[model samples]
Target: MSGQNCWGYGGDNGPLNWHKQFPFAQGDRQSPIDIVSAQAVHDADLTPISISYSACTSLSICNSGHSVMVEFEDCGDKTVVSGGPLENPYKLKQFHFHWGQRGRQGSEHTVDGKSYPGELHLVHWNSTKYNTFGEAAVSHDGLAVVAVFLETGDKHANLHRLTDALYMVKFKETKAQFKDFDPQCLLPKCRDYWTYPGSLTTPPLHESVTWIVFKEPILVSEKQMDKFRMLLFSGEEDSEKQPMVDNFRPPQPLKGRTVLASFKL
Candidate 1:
């Protein structure tokens, strides 16, 4: 069921029914788990992560019928994330977002049972071990995703550049040229995070991601968030127009897996 697109976030084809098409949905290391901060073990060995994205070559932005994604040129090590829990430098493949209609309920991973308005996933592949992103996506230690929670507060100036372009790819399968947009600007001031072994929040739900969820959230205003909701799930030809909202997968069970914190609480 690799690359399958039949699933959605609605009645019959939603997350609850994803296991039927992609069995990995029921895997032991599935993602978007509720992060109980008190239970997370602080690992002193966990060093601060290093990110080099200034030289990133962003190609385009697209609406993949599920979320908004910005693709990058990952042919070289110009942009990469290393250190932390990762043994090798992972090249940045792409970055995307998951959001909700309202301001309080969109993030995939929750902290102490608290949900944020949105979440940002910076996906990277182990270019050293795997030839391509597809090859690395299924391997045990081939992918690393840096998750950042989005909170509602002041308007994020950098985010507006993305929201402004969302109108171009308002329909499913639509894409627009989005070059040289540095994703580094979207990150928060704090880099403290929690690390764990988990799977993709979306299908095919490969249990391959080394999750690095940040401790602090970047602020964006309600107006800025409303721009994301302006996107549509339906294609240009579809008779029914469904507004793209609540595109997040709910938190899964921790299943006794340990969550390691980079900083002590």
Candidate 2:
């Protein structure tokens, strides 16, 4: 997906076949693992993560072939996240969603083997140690991602703004200007989460992410979820159009990784 390999979330190019192109897909630290709450260890030292997006500004939204992502201006420390197993504040880079076509089986990560309808990933980089995002992406202590699950019920006002812009970038390689969007509106009420070391769910599946998956999921109306399924995986010029749904990868093996919970349960 980074180059011209044309990786996708379908047959021949789906998650199961990714290991052929990117060996890290089968690595020990692969992400989107099923978070078995009962088996997770409670760490008293894990701090509550505080996200400050007060000064955040959205740049643009694009259909990245894999998922629809909203980019943010990570300049002047405008937006950042700290605490919760983080040694230093990480700068917000982008946020994206992974969803299923029309069911409750879309999320990449699950809890006690239960998958959500969708999931959001807020990707960040360790600016305190890395010179650039590209350099940090491959480093062991480089990236941090906050994952929030999505359930159907009520429509989210903040998310509606994004849903409205989806029409502009319906096809792959398309983008639209989306400014002044604050990501804080998307987080769940509770900050308690499960933290573990894992790799990117996409190609080049770099094993450099420190994932923080929230315990509670946010709410979205059934109508709102329908908008996400309207996106296309193929470009506008392609003869055949493939709807971009069920873009999430399945949960991988835990491989004896110690999952730390931020709060005692």
Candidate 3:
């Protein structure tokens, strides 16, 4: 995975190619934005959502162009975040990171129009209620994601174990057990979030997703920031070292959609 071997940019997994690559990922309504908002229309049927964590067998931190992600694999126990009436309830899949220059913005979702320095995405899928993410695409409420924004501050460093694996992703097939880690701590106590339907920011820009972008951002240090910059892009060259920045897709037109929130405590 360290030799330009990943295939999202110019290869099979590229954003533009996803519709064809993944059957259910099709549709003109993909996310990452530019879909202009309608009169704050309504999703009167929305459900309450929350995330729960479990154990994992292995993890991989990679420089995925969007951010240096500490990707989880064979993870244990995925909890559902949404409530009743949802056609497809979401199940935790994996978590990844998105960052920008120390002083710049990198978050994909904005609050009342505010961007942050970085964002964390907890990707989940609807289990058949769809057999695969490919199948969930057409299911209105197919996929759900919990996002946490990261800001630079003096907050205790808890993500060190995550970034420490950046070197391991270059090797691929390698595994590491990340014990006793909890994603809830990575989330701010305030659960106010901007909700909308979006797509995978990475290549294959699959549109079948319901995004829950948090309002309050978590804190990280400068060292945590540099750890992200150390990721190697699957090849032994400096140019392959394109620092992971703006892996976020520019907000798409809101296209007559409503963005909801659960901020009121």
Best by lDDT: 1
Residue 223 displacement in candidate 2 (angstroms): 0.6
Clashes of each: 0, 0, 24
Tens-digit lDDT track of model 3 for 1-265: 1112234444666545655765534545555553223323335455555555544323444444444444455333355566522355576656777666554676666554656677788877787477765676545667777888788886446677676656655422333445455666687877655677666665445566777766678888867776665553344444544444445544555656666645432
Prediction 2 global C-alpha lDDT: 0.89
Please report the TM-score between candidate 2 and the true structure.
Answer: 0.97
lDDT tens per residue, model 2, 1-265:
1212368777897889998988898798998899989889999998899899998888999988888888988676768999989999999999999999886788999998999999999999999999999988998879999999999998988899999889999999899999999999999998899999998888888899999999999999899999999999888899998999888888999998999998777
> RMSD (Cα, Å) of candidate 2?
1.5
| Candidate 3 Cα misplacement greater than 4 A, ranges | 1-28, 34-47, 55-67, 70-78, 84-88, 137-139, 170-180, 237-240
Model 1, 114-189: lDDT tens digits are 9999999999999999998898999999899999999999999998899999999999989999998999998889
Q: Cα deviation of 85 in candidate 1 (Å)?
A: 0.5
Candidate 3 structure, TM-score to reference: 0.74
Query: What does the lDDT read for residue 87 in candidate 3?
Result: 52
TM-score of 1: 0.97
The superposed Cα distance between candidate 2 and the true structure at residue 218, in angstroms, equals 0.5
The per-prediction CA RMSD against the true structure, in angstroms, equals: 1.5, 1.5, 4.9
Better of 1 and 2 by TM-score: 1
Per-residue error (Å), model 3, residue 212: 0.9
Question: TM per model?
Answer: 0.97, 0.97, 0.74
